[model samples]
Target chain A: MRKLYTKKLSKKDQLKDLEARKETVQFLLNYSKALRVVKCRGFTFDAILN
Target chain B: MNNVEITDAVLVREYMQGNETALSKLINRHHHRIYSFIFSKVFDRDVAEDIFQDTFIKVINTLKRGKYNEEGKFLPWVMRIAHNLVIDHFRRNKRMPKFDNSGDFNIFSVLSDSDLNVETQIIKDQIENDVKELIKELPEDQLEVLTMRIYKDMSFKEISERTGVSINTALGRMRYALINLRKIIEKHKLVLTN
Candidate 1:
């Protein structure tokens, strides 16, 4: 399976991979904040839906 | 320095001086990354949070004893403390972490609050799960470095300092981590084509 990505990935693909990782990092950081909020005050599903 | 940095540095110094609020602020600022790093390694949120608090307690104690020098980057220094706590935990547990098949062990699973549309949340969860699977296939050293770099946000230099390896070797580990992750993704045929 490594053969498949190795064949398709160019330098451009590497750049895109890096960009994707950056976005994931930002998502994870924001996700951390969300978890903290939940810990302090349980899920707010009703609040969100209201 | 800015408020955050000054606040962090001040808190570190104050905690060193035995101010409780300052110590709390330091934990509030850095607990997320530290917790996430430990959670990813041990794959248990409850245990992760326990270790997270323990790490801070150790830091506070160390500071009071004048054991920690006020390094310019308080964040990195604090992370080093958390990293050591995690290693100690694994040593004490005497068991390797098993893959959590139910997706319960995926740290990101907790993100699937009912607030978001169910479909969107599920997709996000699936991606995170696939990423974890890909990580499992990476070589141990590459996996450790990738976890440290990505989850902990530690710079190559910091990782080098902590691991006692050269900076270039740290950078090379990151490069290999990415390359190996891409390989693993392809091997599993997970559709990350880009």
Candidate 2:
């Protein structure tokens, strides 16, 4: 939330942007979840080889 | 085994034993709570998402490196990791609020801006050219104040009167100008000095 943007937005506009913001946040959450799978696989294998 | 009865300690043991799904299960079970915790602190999705990822990365590295010893307290352990990362994020930003190294999150904190000895660095002709180009990217109001203060070598008092804005407004725009310039530099990965 950019303070400048929030300061300028009306209540209705804020509601409109909420859904779009949630969509991006959802994407980031899923991306982070997917990245963990890769990181765990590589590191776990390294643990075994060590 | 019912998921309800499976404890964090058990999942940790299973993951170490090469049960890959065990790691997935642990993450899924705690993802929402952890992400919310980070989001509450940062207020911005981009920043919160970054800290959340870092928290999990540290969690994975510690577990895989066999450094995790907090047997049954996985949630608390993960929360602590998130907390520390959040603190580190604030510390870095606070130390260099005006011109942060967004990529490394460690520009001014490593060495304060004064230590950079900008007086000598100003002798580099390229730096002057690069700075001029960067300031052009600033918003109109911010650019006005920054240009006045730096290139024109005008005081904030003079800037406020010339711009017909208050001294505080002039000062704020100047600060924002520097911060935005840093963001642009970080985004482009541009190096102004050798």
Candidate 3:
């Protein structure tokens, strides 16, 4: 991989990134869970259907 | 073509016909390419793992229900599911996060609410405990950052200094930790809250 150097983040940008992460965690969590409910339990026809 | 490798199409057919191990063969055969594809898009291992597992979960469901009919195109079909999952990941991220960590940034507000009913409150307590336990499962750096941020109530700057990492790296660890926790919670169908 190339060493693609970048500039340092400003204090404002760092704080902004922190705040953004704090906010988005919940939504991402919910979406990931919704993708599968059958895997937790065994893979059965009734479970997949329902 | 006897020396030729068994094709994915053949594996899918066998799995559908009650050969359970065929699926594992298929997974092993394509795991690297599919995983790399997912990781390239998300650029995070935890998120990529979730997406990869979810992709195959969807695949198994389709195959079990006898709905997989994309003959001779198994890899592409799987790739499509992975692609859609990547889209789903970003779609959720793009939404305006509903948290209100506003000007004061009160951590308590994010952690608990006074208005929950009895059942939900109890469940939330259990989930919180489970999340705390899950902390031990995180990578060392992520565990360190999460421990300090949530329990010790340290700001990112403080965590960055204590951990000897940039603020961005600190936040990244927290994100990966939460992502893994949420994946486990969902896999078990644990209702963390109302």
TM-score of each: 0.38, 0.43, 0.42
Candidate 2, residues B93-113: lDDT per residue as tens digits?
898764534343655466755
Residue pair clashes in candidate 1? none
* lDDT, candidate 1, B11-112, per-residue tens: 777755555567556655666666666666665546666676666555644565466777668888767877888888888776764444452256654445
The root-mean-square deviation over C-alpha atoms between each candidate and the true structure, in angstroms, is 22.3, 18.3, 25.3
**What are the runs in model 3 whose C-alpha is more than 4 Å off?**
A1-45, A48-50, B1-3, B96-194
Error of 1 at A32 (Å): 24
Candidate 1 — which residues are off by over 4 angstroms?
A1-50, B1-5, B95-194
Which has the higher DockQ value, candidate number 1 or candidate number 2? Answer: 2
Angstrom error of the Cα, residue B53, model 1: value is: 1.7
Separately for all candidates shown, the number of backbone clashes (residues 3 or more apart, or on different chains) is: 0, 0, 0
lDDT scores for all predictions? Answer: 0.64, 0.72, 0.72
